[model samples]
Target: MSKQTDAAKEGVQQLDAAAAKVRLAELAKALGAANAAYYQDDAPDLSDAEYDALKRENAALEARFPDLKRPDSPTEQVGAAPSAGFSKITHSQRMLSLSNAFDASDVQDFVGGIRRYLGLGDNAPLPFTAEPKIDGLSLSLRYENGTLVHAATRGDGTTGENVTSNARTISDIPTTLSGAPEILEVRGEVYMSHADFAALNARQEDAGDKTFANPRNAAAGSLRQLDPAITKSRPLRFFAYAWGEVSVPLAETQTDALARLEALGFQINDRTKTCDSGEEMLAHYARIEEERADLGYDIDGVVYKVDDLSYQRRLGMRSTTPRWAIAHKFPAELAWTSLEGIDIQVGRTGALSPVARLKPVTVGGVVVSNATLHNEDYIAGRDANGAPIRNGKDIRIGDTVQIYRAGDVIPKVADVDLSKRPATAEPYAFPTACPQCESQAIREEGDAVRRCTGGLICPAQAVEKLKHFVSRAAFDIEGLGAKQVEAFHTDGWIKEPADIFTLRERFGQGLQQLKNREGWGEKSAENLFQAIEEKREIALARLIFALGIRHVGEVAAADLARHYTSWDALAETVDKAAPAATAHRAAEEAIVAERAKAADEGRRANLSAARDAAWADTQPEAKAAWDDLIGIDGIGATVAVSLVTTFQQATERASIDRLVAMLTPTAPETRATDSPVAGMTVVFTGSLEKMTRAEAKARAESLGAKVSGSVSAKTDLLVAGPGAGSKATKAAELGIETIDEDGWLALVGDG
Candidate 1:
C-alpha cells in the first residue's frame, strides 16, 4: 500500500471536510463489503494489502476532519460481526487486536511512543518480548478451579462463538491444570501444519469433499464444524500466548508468565525471547524470517510486547488494540516489476508452466527475475476455481505486476497493476501449441495445468528428462553437468540417457576425433568416459528418481526402493499392474465427479453403488501390487497413478529400458546395528556449530537413524541448536528427548 495509490482515493489533497466526508462514505461501503465476505461468507474478496489500505485511508480522513467523521467510521471497529451459525460467548475482558507495524520506521515509532507515554528517558531500559505471530484463528479458553470449561473464537472482540466441544478436540489444550487460580482465561492461536493441511486436502479429495485454500482457512473451517467429531478428525495445534482473565498474576514479566503457562501444561512457542533494545528485537525478527520456511507452520509476523507487567499496565488499551504490544509484520515480500517476457517451460511430465521473466528487482533480500504464472487461466486473471484474481485484472507482456513469496523459494505473481499497464500491451494469448516441438497442448478436465501431448518427442521435455536422469540426486556422474548434457544432446551425440555410456565406443574412434573438438581435449574426453563407466552401477532409489515420474520426488523414490529393493521386481510389478490401477483411478474420479453433481439423495445413492461396483470390478491378480503400492505411507492414488502410468507408456517404457540396460541398480546401504541411534527418528533444528544439516542427516542415516523433516509423536530425538522455535517447544510438549550437538556426536561415537 503506497501513499501515491491511496492519494486518488483519499489523497492528501482531500484534506477538506467535504472531500473527507465523501472519502469516508466510500471507505464505509468498501469496509462493510470486505467484512461481510471475510466473516459471514468465509471468502475474502480483498487481499490483506487492500483491506489494510482501506483502513488506513479511513483513518487518515478521520484524522484531518474529526468533526466531519461519520458515525460508521472503521476507526471505532474491531473484528467483524460474529457468525450467526454459532452461539455467541461474551468475553470477560475485551479480546482486542494488535496494531501492526509494517516496517522498521513504524517499529521505531512504536518504541518511541511507548517511551513517551511512560515518560521514560531515551537511555531507559525498556525490555520487550518478541514472539512469532502465528497466522491462525485466535481462541480463548476458560477454565474453572483447574478444570477445563469452555472455549470461544475471537468473533467481535466483545462477543465470540462458543465452541467448547470443538476446542476440546485440540490435543494441545489440557483438560485440567494444577497450582492455578480459581478461574483463568488462556488466549492463544489454533493452527494447522502445512503437512497436515496437505494430508487433509488429500483426504477431502478422496472423499469428494470440499478442500480449503490454505492452512489458516482449513483450521478455521475445521474448528467451526458443527460436529465435534469432525473437528477431532482435523490435526490442529495450539499455542498459549496471552491471557484474558485470571484470578491472580502468573508472573511479573511476559517471559516468566509464558513459562508459568508452560508449567501448567499449555504449549508455548519457545522462540519467545526477551530483548533489551528495539534493535535486538528487530534482529530477532530477521532471524525468524530467515527460518520461516522450516517452522512447519505459518506465521505472518513477530509481536513485541512490553515485557514488564507493571509498565504494560501504565500504557493500557486503545480503542481496538493494546498500547503495550504491537505486531511488527514482515514487508509484503512483494515488488512491482515489468513483465519482460512470458516463456513456456515444459516439465518432465510435459506440463507447460508459464514463467514470467521480470526485470530484476530485490524482494526480501533476494533478487527475483522469474515468477510462476501457474497456468493459462492465471494469466487471464482466473484461479484454479475460475474465481477472479487481482480483481479480475489480467497480466500483459509490458504490464507491471506485483510478485510475492511466503516462505516459498519460488516467487509468484500476486497481482497486476492495470494502472501502469502499457497502452501497447495486448491481451496475452496463451499458445495451444508446444513451444518446443509444435505439438498440440491440451488441458485435462478437472486439472488446471495445460500439458504438451508430445511425450518423449518434445525436445524440451526430452532434454529436461535427460538432465534430471544424470543430475546430482540421480545418476550423478562425476564429469556430467547440465552444460555437458545440452552439448551432447544438441550434437546428436546423445539422444537418450544410455548414449552417455556408449559415447566412447561410438565417437572415440570416429573421424571427428575426440581431441580436436572445441572445449574438449584428449585427457578431458577420456576422463569423462571413465567417469561414466565408474557410474555403471548406482543406487536403486537414485535410478527411480532419475525416471522423472510425476509426483515421484526423491523421498518417494527412496520409499519405493526401500519397499521393492530391486529394480526388476518394482518395474515388473508396476508394468503388469498399471492397467487395473489406471482403470480403478478412472472409475474413482468419475464416481467423485458424479456424486458431486448428483442433486437428489436417490441419485447420490446410485452413484455410491456404482463406486462400490467399480471397486469390485478391480482385478484380484493385480490387486496385491496395487494395494502394496498404495499401502506405503504417503504413496497415495496420485503418486501411484504417476509411477505406474509412466511405466505404462510405450515411449517412456522404451526410454527407461535404454537407461536400465546401461546401469545396474544396487540396494540401499546397510545400517550399523551397533550404533545407539539405530532405528530412531531424529530431527535437527537451527544451525549446528560444527557441521551442516546435510552432513548431520547423512551421518544419522549411516548410523541407522531416519531423519525426518518435522517433529511428531514418532520423533525419538530432537537436536536443538540456538534459535530453535516451534519444533523444540512441540518436542518438549510431546516428551521427545532433546540433545545438543555434542550429545549427538557422543551418541554416534564421534565425541
Candidate 2:
C-alpha cells in the first residue's frame, strides 16, 4: 500500500476510536446522574427500561475497553458524592451506610454471612433493630446546654455540611431540648409528610409555581437550600435514628437512645422495634412493607441493625458499611398507564407546573389518576428530536406513560412512548395566567418556574396557609386539621388562625346548637376546645411558625425568639422598621457609591464592612424588640422579617392580639445536673451481670450518667461483669477507668 493511503486509514481508525470513547463517556455520565437522582434526590430522571438500557450499554463499553473506565465510574460507587452547598463536617464516629438485600434469598444470604462472621451455631439467635429506611435527607443535630447548636447533612458518611440554620426550620426539631445531655449529637432523616406535600403542591398550583416531583425530592431540595429563609418555607420534619459525638453516653441499647431522643423532644420513628432474631427482623420488614403505602411519608426499605452493641463491635465494619447493619429493600412498584391528557397547575408561590392526567390505575393498593410532569422542559423532553418521553422526552395526549410508585404514595410518570402518541395530539401549551386568580404570570431569569402575581386572595393559597398553621409539625392543634380548617373557613367560623382561638366565645351558645345539627357533638366540640386550650402555652418557636407567615419557619422562629425574647417586642420593632422599598433604595445607592470609589485603596472593602455593620446594628435592635420579648432560642433576622410581614395587616395584628390574650407562654425548661451519675460515663457490657439489659439501661439513665454500649476514650467507667468481651479489652488498652458490678452498685449507693 502507498504511505499516504496508510496514513489516511490510520487517521480514520483513530477518529472512530475517539468517537466510541465519547459515546461510552456519555453513557456512564447518564447512568451516574440517574442513580444519583433515584437514590439521593428520590426523583428518578429515567424510567427503569431507559436506565437499564443505559446501564447495559455502559457495562458493554467498559467490558470492551476496560482501560477506559474512570476512577469515579458509577459502577465503583455505592451512592452520590455529598452536596457542595453545605459546610463539610467530619463525624466524631463515622456514620456508615448499610448493605442492601433485595429479596428473601438475599436476606438469607445476609443472615448466613452474619452467622459465619460471629461464629454462631446453626440456630444461634441474632438480635436486630428493624426500622424503616426513611427516604429523606440524613442529618446530624448537635445540642449543647440543652439547646440545638448545630445541624449537619450526611455528606460522605465521614463528613457533612453544616445546615444548622436551615434545620431549625423543621418544627419537630426542638430548639432547646428537655432532659438532654450536656452535649448530644443525634442523627436522623428530614422528610415531608404526604399530606403536607399534597397541600404544598396544591398551593404551588394555585399560585402558578412549579410543583416538586415528589415528597422526598421536595424535602431534599428544601434542606439543601443555602438560605435558611427558603428552607423555612418548606414543610419539613425530622426523625432521629442514631447518635454521633456526645459528651454523655445516651443509652445501653439502640432502642434506649431512640427513647431518649424522643424524651428530649426529638422525633423518633415509631415503627422501630427490637427483634430477638433475624427471623423476627424479617417478619417486621414484611409487616412494614405490607403497610408502607398507608404510611404518611416515604420509606424505601427497612434497616436492620444488630441490637447488641457488643455483637456489633465483634462484627466491626468493612469500608463504608458496618457488618452489623443491612437494608432490606422491597421491590420497586411500577405500572404502565395511558396518558389521557396534560393539565397545568398554578402554585401558592405563583409558579406554573404541568401535571399528567393518566388512566386510573391501582398501584400498591391505591388508585392513581395523575402524576407530576414537573416543568415545561420536562414535558417537552428537552430533546432535539422531541421524541415522546417523560423524563427526557415529551408525552403526547395519547401516549403510554410508565408510572412508578416508589416509597412516595404519589405515582410519577417515568417514560412516554412516542409510537403510541396519537397523530391528532397537539403540543400542550402551559397557562400564562393563574387559573384561580387570573393574575399575570411571569418566569424570572435563571429560574425554571412560571409564577402568578396573586397573593393571599386566592382560595387555594388561603386553604393551604390555614392548613400549614394547624399542621402537626407546626401549631399541632390536635382537633383542627385540613378538613376542619376548610370547613370553618367556608362557614366563617375562622378567618385566620387567631380567629380559631375565639370560635368558642363568639359561637359558644350556637356551638351547642350546631353540634346537635350534623356531623358535630357535645363530646367532639369539647375535645376540640380542649385541644385548642392545650396549645395556648406552646413555645415561641411553634407559635411563630403557626402564624402562617411567609418564609418564617421553625428555625427562624427560634432564632427570632432567642434574639428578641418576646413576641410583643418583635411585633413593635417590625412595625417600625424600614420598608423593603427603603432597604432596596439604600442598597442601590450604596452599590453606586462603592463602584464610584472603587479606585480608592481598600475603600470597597471598608465601605462594604461599614454597610454590613450598620445593617447588623439596625437588625439587632429591631430583632431584640421581638425575640427578647418571647425568650425563645435561635430566632434570627429572616424569621423576624417573616413575622413582621405576616402581622403587617391590621386584621392580622388584631388576630395576633387576640391569640396573645388567650394564650400564656410557658417557662422554658431548666437544665438539670443533679443526677447521681451526672458526671460519669458508663458502658454496659456482657450479658448484664445483675439485671436485664433494659433494667440496667433504665437504672443507669435514672442516675444521670449516660450509658453507652461500646467502650471509647471518653467513657469514664466500663461496667463489666459476666460475658465481657472485646470492649473490656479495648477499655483496658485505652487505660479507661473501669468499674465492676459491685463498684457500680456502690457508686449508685445500692451496695
Candidate 3:
C-alpha cells in the first residue's frame, strides 16, 4: 500500500485529539519534505493528488481547531526556501496562492462570499475571468524600459531564485517587448508540453540519466539548471496571465490585463473567457475540465478571478489567498485495478473497516495500492439502506474494481466489473470476531460497521485511546508519539491515561525505569518526563477532547468547554442530563422497534406516538437538564447523548476522575461581555444585505451571542432582511424581538 493510503485509513473526523495532533505533525513533516524534494531538489516525493490530499487534510484540521494550529504549519508557508545554488531575488509583490474550490457549491460560495463582502446585490454585474490553472512552476519576468532585466521562480512567494539566463533561453519568453510599460513584471507559469516532456524523458533514459516524473517536474528541473544551455536544449513554454510591480496599470480589468500581456508578445491561454455570473464561470470551468485531456499540457483546475481591478483591490487578501479569486479544482479521477485481497483493520472505536489491497495502478498520476471497502454491506453489493448497488455485484478477491479518490478523502471502490471477476473466487465472509483480540464483533442495528465488544481489553482500542490522550491537541507529551504509546502499552509500562502521570514516581528510580529501557537514555527520558510535567496544567477544551468521547470532536469539545466554563460544571451537567439522555435513547429505540415490527407485518406504525410514550416516564428535572445541555450553541442531542453516556460508565468516569486529579484544567476563554447581543440567541433569516449568513453568524458568535438556525421561544432576537419568509413570521408569532438588516448593523455597532 502507498504511504498515502496507509495514512488515509484514519479519517480526519474519526481522529481524536491525540491522533489528530500526531497526524498533523506527520502531515507537516511529510509535506515539508515533499516540498523541499519538489521545489528545491526537483525530485518529487509525493504525487500531486497525494500532496493535495495531505494539504487539504492539514487545512481542514486547522480550520476545525485554529487554537491547535502549528507554528510550522504548511498552510501558512508557500514553498520550501530557495535552493542555496541560486541567487535569491525578493519579489516586488508577493505571488499569492489561490484557495481551492473542489465542488460546484464551493465555487458558488466563493462568488457569494465576494458579493456578500462587497455588499453587492445578487443581480449585480460581477464579472470574473475564468482560465485554466496550469500545473507548473510560477515564474516572474521583470522588464525595465521594455527590456527583460531579470526572471525568477516563485521559491517562497516573497523571495524567489533568480533564473534570468535560463528564462531568456526559452523561445516563448521575449528578451525585449514593444508597447509595454517602463517597468512591467509579467508573472505566469513555466511548463513543458506533454509530447516535449515525453521526448525529453526518452532522451534522458537513452543517455542512462534519471528520467523526470512528469511534465511539471521536467520543466522545473530543466529551467533551474546552472547551465542555460541545458535549459535551451529542453522545450519549455510560458503563459502570461498576471503581472506584478507595474509602473502603470496594465488594464482596468483582469481580461484586459491578459490581453495587454498578449499584445506585448507574451502568450496567454486562448481558452480564457470573461464570465459575467457564477453560473457562467462554472460553465467555463466545466468546459475547461472537459477539454483538459486534449490540452496537450497538464492543468489541475480552472482559476476564476474578479475581472474589475477596483473590485479585486477592494476584495484584498487573506494571509495566503486572495479573496477575489479561487481555483475550482477538478473532480477525482478513476481507474480500474485488481482487488488482490481484503484485510479487516480495527480502529480506535473498534470499527471493523475492510481495506482492499489492490494491485498497484496509477490513477491520475497517483499510484493506488489500497482503497477503503467501507463496510460489509458495500462488499456485498448493498448500500447502508440495504439497497442494491453496482447492479447487485459483490466484490470478491481477484475481482476488477474501479477506484476513485477525491480531495482529502481516501480512495474508495466505485464499482465492480463482474466480467473481469475470477471464476474461482468465492464470496467474502466478514469476520464475526475481532481479528486482534478474538472478541465478538457484532454489527449493531442501524449501523453499517461491525464493532468489537472488547472495549478497553482490546489492545487495539486501549493503545488507540492512550494515543488519543497524549495527542498534540490533548496532553502533547513531546517524546510520546504513536510508536512510543504502542511500545509502552506492549511493555506494560502504561495502560491508561492516568498511568502517564505516575510514571516518574512508580519507575523513575527503579530497575524498570524508562531511562533504563532499550533505546532510552538519561537525556531522552528526562525530556519525556519534563514534557509530561509541563502538561500538568492544561486548557479545559483540550482535556475534554482528550477524553475521546464519541461525537465529541475538537469543535464540539470547544463548544462544550465554552458553554460549561470549567470541568466541574461540565461533569455536573452531564450527571444531571444522563437520565434524560438515556430516556431519549430508549424512546428512539422503541420507535425503531415499532417501525421494524410494522415493516414485518406489512403495516404502518405511529413512530412519533411510540417515541412519546417511551419518553413520557422521564422525570421533569432530568428532561429540563437535558434541554439545557442541548441548548448550548453548536450542541445537539447527539453530542449530549454521547457526553452523558460516556460519563454514565462508572469505570470510564473513574479513569477520567483519576486523570483529572493529577492535573489542573484552566477555564475556557470568556467571550465579550459588554456586547448588546451577549448571551442572546440570535437567528438570521432571508436576504442579508451587509453580510453573508456565515459572516453574520461568525460576527454574532465573536460578540458572545449564540447563533441558532431556527426561530423558537428560546430565540431572543431575529435579524430579518428582505424576502424574509416562514422564519420571520414564526419569530414574530413567538414574540421574539425582530430587527431589519440596518437595525442589526446598528445593534452590532457596524452601521
- TM-score preference between candidates 1 and 2, better one: 1
Q: How good is model 1 by TM-score?
A: 0.49
| lDDT values, one for every candidate | 0.76, 0.64, 0.80
lDDT of 1: 0.76
Greater-lDDT candidate between 1 and 3 = 3
lDDT value, candidate 2, whole model: 0.64
Residue 561 miss distance in model 1 (angstroms): 0.5
Given candidate 1, what's the lDDT at residue 213? 70
Model 3 steric clash total: 1
Report how far residue 597 has shifted in candidate 1, in Å. Answer: 6.6
True lDDT of residue 53, candidate 3: 60
Q: 1-751, model 2: which lDDT tens digit per residue?
A: 2232232122112222222343343344445556556545546665433443343333333434444443223333334545655667776777665655544555677777777666677777676789998877788888888888888776656667778899888898889977788888888889999999999899889999878777777787788887999889989998889887788778767777788888888788889999987678778988998889899998877888877777775666654567778777655445688988887665434456667888998654446787656566556665223343334566678888777542222345666677777788887777777787888777654445566767556655566667767764467676677678888888877766777777777875445854774677888888888788788787776677676564454445544554344676556666755353234335555666676677575444456654553354455444334433222223334444555556676665776777777776542232225756764657777765444555565566556555554565557788888878898998899898777888878877777
**Candidates arranged by lDDT, highest first:** 3, 1, 2
In model 1, which runs have C-alpha deviations exceeding 4 angstroms?
1-337, 357-370, 403-412, 422-424, 509-512, 600-602, 672-751
After superposing candidate 2 on the true structure, give the runs of residues whose Cα lies further than 4 Å from its correct spot.
Answer: 1-300, 304-328, 343-354, 364-366, 375-377, 380-392, 441-452, 555-565, 572-644, 647-658, 673-751
Candidate that would win on TM-score: 3
